[model samples]
Target: MYDNYAKVIVKGSPITKSNFKLFNVNGRAILPMNSGKYHDRYAIYEEEIAFNARSQNPSKVLDEALIAVLKVYYKSEKRHPDTNNITKSIFDGIEKSGLIINDAQIRRLIIEEFYDKENPRFELELFGESSFSMDYSIKPREILEEKITYNPPSNKKKALNDRMNISAIKPKISDNICEVCGKGTCKENLISANKGKTLICRTCFKKLF
Candidate 1:
């Protein structure tokens, strides 16, 4: 088994999953085909990657178990493709490049995407079954920390679930109290804001607005 690394630098944007159109045939949802722009870019990627692989002059393709790890750095921040979608596109390109007999031979796959404003390219690392079993000591360190106020996809879903589950933990807006300002006002006349999560009297809402 072997461990190999190759870099492919291409000029165009990668195709995203959203670029395909869905058709309903016989009540079944089917993805008809990728858009023409996607095919065009993919063709270019295949050619460039194939040339680079040949230049590197690797050994004959292994017919045994294989694994591929891909790191894709995209150039534009304007378009964010699903990370998995970009992997699929590159996988096809790798297969067409004849770097391997078929992509189906790949068992374990990992793909990541990053943003690069000036240059967009993909770096791939291929590992054979034996190479993965060997002892390796490469530990990655985080160079940057990005702090976001909102949660990520998984945490966002969890947050939403928590919010939905706390239906009984509502603010008690008494008939004579404003929940926001704690002003004495008739509850029947208080304005319900933020989908009932927050209760504010008309005066407070008007003042804040």
Candidate 2:
């Protein structure tokens, strides 16, 4: 297992043995495991920072679905939405479209399963577990957060994902209502949100935004 960590990291994944670890069978010594079966990882998290089209706010997943709907409605197989250029007009289209899932529980389905890299087209299965992801990688929000340093990606799709971050943020207009109050916007009401949409109250938007 130690060798596996070395080999895997040696192959790639700069995670050192110290970084890629779990308790050993004896339950005291920490050792690196290669199975990559960490449950907390690949699972949606309360404090987990999501940084992509398929992440950020759970409801934002609908934005992706609407994009697909636009492609179909327009009868085009190739579409590249300038998320950097989303306007109130585009948002209205998403809100009016029947494909939108307003409920939070269904959110995991859309982001985790439906819009995933493997399944780009819509596939709404009733009984299935959500896709697993890790919080370790900073690639998702690497550009947005200034404190961290990031190395750019070489893969074509990853390069695309890396480039299109939620840059179209609008400042909060309301102070009384928590920006994320009714929405499943944050881990808890502990936050509203500010991925650039939905006016987040000053209190909620301050820390993360």
Top TM-score prediction, candidate number: 1
Each candidate's lDDT (Cα)?
Answer: 0.63, 0.28
lDDT of 2 at 78: 33
User: For residues 87-148, what per-residue lDDT tens digits would candidate 2 score against the true structure?
Assistant: 22222222333223432223222222112233232212211123322233335763566463
Question: How does each model score on TM-score?
Answer: 0.50, 0.15
Off by over 4 Å in 1: 1-12, 21-39, 55-60, 134-144, 148-209
Task: Report the error of model 2 at residue 125, Å.
Answer: 16
